[model samples]
Target: MSTTETHHALWVAYGASGVVGTIRKSDEGYTVTMAGADAAAGTYPTMEIAKGALHSHMTPGSDWPQFREH
Candidate 1:
C-alpha cells in the first residue's frame, strides 16, 4: 500500500555535478525525470519502484565509467 502524502522533490547528484535523475509524486502516480525532461524516464505505480528506477543515477559507485583525473 502507498500513501497520498506529498513529498518534496527527490534528486540524486554527484558532488558539485548536476542531478542525474529525480522522482516526483502526482495525482496519477510517481514520475521519473532524467536528462532534463519530465516523464522522460518512466512512471511507476509505487514510490519504491520509482526509487529503484533511479538506480546509480542517485547512488555513487563504480558503475559509472572511470575517467582520468585532470
Candidate 2:
C-alpha cells in the first residue's frame, strides 16, 4: 500500500493602520497586496507565522508585552 500527503502555502502582511493581508498558493509561492499599494511577493518555509501575522494585524487594539529584561 502507498500513501500521499499534501501541504498548503500562505502569505501574510501588516499595514500602517493595522490592516491585515493574506494569500494562498495555487502551486508554490504566495502573493500579497496592501491598500492601494503595489504588490509584494515572497516565500516561506511554513504557514504558521504567516497566519499569525494576519491575526496580530487585525487585533491591534489588544495589548502586547514589552520586553525589559535582557
Candidate 3:
C-alpha cells in the first residue's frame, strides 16, 4: 500500500534545460508553475492531473522527461 505523506513541491526538468517547472501542493490542490512565471498556470485536484497539466503546458514537440518525486 502507498503511504500518504505531505508533499510541498516538485521540480520538473526536460532535455538540456534542468528544472523547468514546479508542482506545488496546497490546500486547494496541486499548482503547476513554469520557470520564470509570475503566477501558477492552474491547480488540479490530483497530482496525476497536475502532472498531465505540466506536460500539456510545456512547449510542443518536446519529449516527456522521467519525473522523479522528491
lDDT string for model 2 (1-70, tens) is 9986655544444444543456565455443333344554343334554344334544467443221111
TM-score for each model: 0.50, 0.33, 0.73
Residues 44-69 of candidate 3 have per-residue lDDT tens digits of: 99988988888887778767755666
RMSD of each: 8.9, 9.7, 4.6
lDDT of 1 by residue, 1-70 (tens): 8878664454442233544566666676767666465445777888777766665454466243221111
Report lDDT (CA) for all predictions. Answer: 0.56, 0.43, 0.77
At residue 27, give the lDDT of candidate 1.
71
Flag regions of model 1 displaced more than 4 Å. 1-18, 56-70
The ten-residue window of minimal lDDT in model 3 covers 7-16
Backbone clash pairs for candidate 1 read none
Worst 10 residues of 2 by lDDT: 61-70
Winning model by TM-score: 3
Q: Against the correct fold, how does model 2 do in TM-score?
A: 0.33
